[model samples]
Target: MLRYYGVDLLDHHRGTLSARRVWVLLKHLPRDSAFARELHGEESAWGLGEHLLASVIDHLAIGNWLFTSAHTAEGESPPDPPVPVPRPGVADEEDETPAASAGEQDLAWFFADL
Candidate 1:
């Protein structure tokens, strides 16, 4: 998962600073530590919630790195768009603005309560 997101644990200078920091945290955190127990449970067994939380944190770090790199890249041409241009007569769903769905609202509520 870390490699998929360009985090190079073997090389200190390879990955982004934020990603490296995340790697350090995960690497140094003991399985039976108080922080781990608090985050999970007394047994420190990972459940679905723990997996999802880790994934969200990893993605957020990658996103932050991307934004910072884009702004700091001096005189570099921006990369080509990932998606192709929309056809003249065809409506692209990706171009549409979506209202918050029921699931999104529920997820927001869940996090708020946490």
Candidate 2:
């Protein structure tokens, strides 16, 4: 059976690459390879600098797509996974009613002009 994955670019300002190229690069990530060097080498080609490239790698690492290490050159292991960020509009488990779903609160405003 074949498997497929998807990558959505939320931040359009970062970089650009053909879909094929992106796929090819991500294909190497599973092996726990040294991706930082490859990214740094192709930084110019990808139209991103060290900081931006690191950000991309960090995002992938945080998303669990790839493992990364700051001291990989010295044979250190991949760092711990980054903390997951909460998405906007996602209510915490404890919050019974989020701001958007504030029941009956907006009804007063709705009938104010009526």
Candidate 3:
């Protein structure tokens, strides 16, 4: 069933598989039947718990994606990326005050001793 939907378990575990695709496949799982039993295997199987957990995670991801997609589908543009705030006492390029020098600096001074 998973393979039919291009969901490789390894890729899913690594988060490389698409959650929407997995959700589509999972939602179509047979309901309460011998075939479903055979597909998922015996309830006593050691891997059944892992499979169930994966399904739950996929559903959550899909739900979040759908929620965001719904807003865009309704003619709303996605929010813009956040703009960076200037540090205090820093001067803008157009101002007469000297702008901070551009270079890599050691950040160890910013932290307190553990």
lDDT for each residue of candidate 1 in 22-56, tens digit (9 for 90 to 100): 54564456655554544444434554566677667
**Residue pairs in collision within model 1:** none
Q: Clashes in each model (backbone N, CA, C under 3 Å)?
A: 0, 0, 0
Highest TM-score: give the candidate number.
Answer: 1
Candidate 3 local lDDT, 7-96, one digit each (tens): 564675587866565555555755443334444433313344556676677677666666776677556775543333333343678777
What overall lDDT goes with each candidate model?
A: 0.50, 0.43, 0.49
Q: Which ten residues in a row have the lowest lDDT in candidate 2?
A: 36-45
What's model 3's lDDT at 65? 64
1-114: candidate 2 lDDT, tens digit per residue: 012234443222255545445545445443223332233332213323545666776687665634345435566566666754443334568776433333235334533443
Q: Which stretches of model 2 miss by more than 4 angstroms?
A: 1-75, 91-100, 108-114
* Deviation from truth (RMSD, Å), model 1: 20.7
Candidate 1 is scored at a TM of: 0.28
Q: How well does each candidate superpose onto the true structure, as a TM-score?
A: 0.28, 0.24, 0.25
